[model samples]
Target chain A: MKILEDEKIVGLFFERNEKALRETEASCGALLRKTAKAILESDSDVEECLNDTLLSLWQNIPPAVPKSLRAYACKVIRNLAFKRLEYGLALKRSINSELPLDELEAVLFDLKTENEFSDVEFTLTLDSFLGSLSAESRAVFLKRYFFCDTVPQIAQDLCISESKVNSLLYRARKKLRSVYEKGAEL
Target chain B: MKKYRLSKALGEIDEVYIEEVLKYTEDAAAGKRRGIFGRKRIVTLALAAVFIAAGTTVTFAAACGGLQSISEHFTAYRTDIKGVGDTSSLPVIENAWSIGKTMDGEQDALAGSIKVTSAVCDRYSLYATIEFNAEGIDIPENIPDEELTFDIINAKSGIEGACRPVFVSREGDIFTYIIHFSESSSINGDEIFIEAHNFGRSCTVEIENIGRRLVFNSVEYCRIKFSIPVSDLLILDSVQSLNSEKIDGIIDMDAELSPFGFVVRYDESQVPAWEEAHSELLKQYGWEWFKYSTGTVYSLLSFKMKDGSTLENVHNLIATAESGSDPNSGKDTIHFSFIVPVDISQIESVTYLGAEFRFDAEAYD
Candidate 1:
């Protein structure tokens, strides 16, 4: 089967063709499924969440248009998967009790002092700090935090040693903390 | 900030930058970083990615576990025929082992007193009856359409805060809050904490002092903290399973029931004749009483209870497993669960679309 390009697939959605969903699945299925599987434990829950994600996209696409269909799909599926995981945890059914985002606490503004800093202001400051970093450094930071990828996974994906990934993360966190401290002082 | 706060912050990231990072990740994974994102795109992406990512913190307001005797004798079945009267039967409030505690508490900020007249629970949800009384303010019942912001936490289990209620209603001076959680929730435990926020405006309230005039700044926001002691809840155990007939040698039906809900499993690959018989059924079922999407079908499962009360299926969760040698050729094994308020043992036969799947009493043993 010939896979449609992202723009063409989006066009199909604009035309309200059900085939738009199929094409989207065909193009982005692996990415979405992989992202969901990383967080969710049950095969059934993962499949259901993915289907729900597609349905949600189909329902919302008339109002939402994304330049990158892949990113949009991944974000939506990831959220649905997280909700599924939370549901499983609520019922005491999750296989893995630990969340992928546990490590983020060290780098985040202290919850105790979270209200002391404004979100929009902090984001802008953090953005400036990231802009100052090299492309490689920025990628490493985002892969660890935003993507919720573990150090081992990041190392393997980046073809670097585990120690290198650790060092990169350490520097990223230190820089982020410094930037936050400065911003907080300001 | 809680994990959800972080998620909200991350949600504010620029869409263009998010796509750029996604593309960058894909390119790196594919070993093709020949064209890196330009400096301007990188700046935008960095700004977007700056939000701290924290794992969701499931916060509950309740403290610890202590089983207290429930002495109140409220009917477990809803009795206001005038309110939910349109239904075929009185909805059974499935709070197993409940003491029928009438909770009462009040917050000063609400400018009114509140009382939890009745509270109940099942494995899947928590239901409470609350009454708000403002001295000079005329409160409109069910003012907010979405849900009241609240978090129910089970101290025993580490499950995060609660979700919005599945149902909410207001009649006269009484407001009903029916908050739902996962079947896996520790709600069956003895103790659970509730942190709730009441958000509304007295726009509809007539200022009696002002001669029945609308109040502009009559915003009502109250944070209430409370807990409920639940004795026992019905879990899917000791269920009477029925031996359903195998259809087309490819699809097999498994049905089980209890007081809380019902489970239906339609397995396509158990027999493995697999010539699209089950698949075709899922597809061709079309938009009848049932709805199908690719590998799964959604339909109502209705059965009459022994009391002549009808319990219709409410789809809560679906579990699907796919099996085939090739990616495109697999059959999906689906388990559909419907949560209802009826006794499973009282059920005589299950009916769907004029077809009855009778339960064999002898085969159950």
Candidate 2:
């Protein structure tokens, strides 16, 4: 079927038309699955995460008219997948521990200090930091940290060398570290 | 903050940032015009030579035509690298040729054809554009871009490399894509094959006059062949030994410089000594010590040009590779590729780790 525009899909959600889920699946199901697969290892878990994403979209759309359904669905799927990943790790499952979270931890090492900031405040700081970056840097940062794309994958997708991806990540992480350092001083 | 908390906070970032990345990926995939809001188009003279072969017209466009476009396109996409992507800079492809060919038999099977519009190469990479035409096939509007995929293979060796196709544009029934091949080994061939596979998508097709909608999957596959003397492309073979002090146990340094970029490789043989040098900071930073140490090492590197200008703190190093993982093993080959394009012929010396490695007259031999 022809993919419906995101606005039309949102309108369907507002109307409580069940077809919205079908359209959503058709339009962004691949993206949602790809997002989940990036974080969750098991296909079953990925399927479950996709279902939860759809359910959340169904329950939340009337109150949340996202500008891009694809982006909104991705966030929901990623969060659900992360929850599954954490639960699996807690249960001592054989989940791989090679997530880029460790790298992110290193990048934000200054945040270990005792000062408390609301999630909103932290997110705002991150948004400002991202805003200060060049478009290429910002995209690479988000693709690696936010999208959980592998370095090789990012390199291939952007038509650059794998080392280039690593360098970009390193530079962005350094910049982020300085951002946190400046924030601590403030 | 904990990593999970930081990740959660990252999730809560404004959707605009997320959208920006998504749009960038889509544009990159499509080979859409790039640079500061996609407004910059660096122009160069592109010579196109057209001829007929086997009743089909084949075109051999000078590779220089697409080299600047490809370089500038990448430059715009990689603005984070200092001194790289300047349109005024010299073209990276010293001698270039772009060959375009049409699929011979695949058109009869699918009622459409795939074409290679342009292919070019530099010293280290190959860039090509492919166009898929579905003139007779009825594809639904707004189909997912992932429904289609393409691959590149070396015709001589029959070896295929991981090729990602970026969508360029769609006009009428033709879709354009651009692919890059970076493996120096795979790209040395004179002929290459491009395979396009449509994994089929559910599209609603209306009965001509009855207005009845029917959903069906459209799967198609085709392979197009093209030949270009990639080996004929200019190769700049300039490798110089880097001179550095014995302070940190890192030794035996060398650099390969080209108009595209420079790569520095060295052996970190005295791991214990290196760790001891930074032991105090390492203890203080814990898990972050490695990052700090590496960042400091990178900051100490600079390039001295023949024009007497210094490219200081060349922090835009784009790629790094290490062979040995065990820190206790005391033998690791560390490689760094700086993404900033520089005229290697104009370079005078490299200052790395507080010692200057000059490109003196004797060293050129």
* CA error at residue B92 for candidate 2, angstroms: 24
Candidate whose DockQ is highest: 2
lDDT, candidate 2, B143-209, per-residue tens? 7654444433333321134454665455567666666544322123344444444424445677888
| A160: Cα error in model 1, Å | 1.9
DockQ of each: 0.09, 0.17
TM-scores, one per candidate:
0.37, 0.44
DockQ result, candidate 1: 0.09
After superposition, candidate 1 runs with Cα above 4 Å error: A95-98, A109-111, A117-132, B29-365
| TM-score, second chain, candidate 2 | 0.47
* Regions more than 4 Å wrong, model 2: B1-3, B32-365
Give Cα distance to truth, residue B196, candidate 2, Å.
38
Stretch of 10 with least lDDT, candidate 2 chain A = A108-117
Alpha-carbon DockQ of candidate 2: 0.17
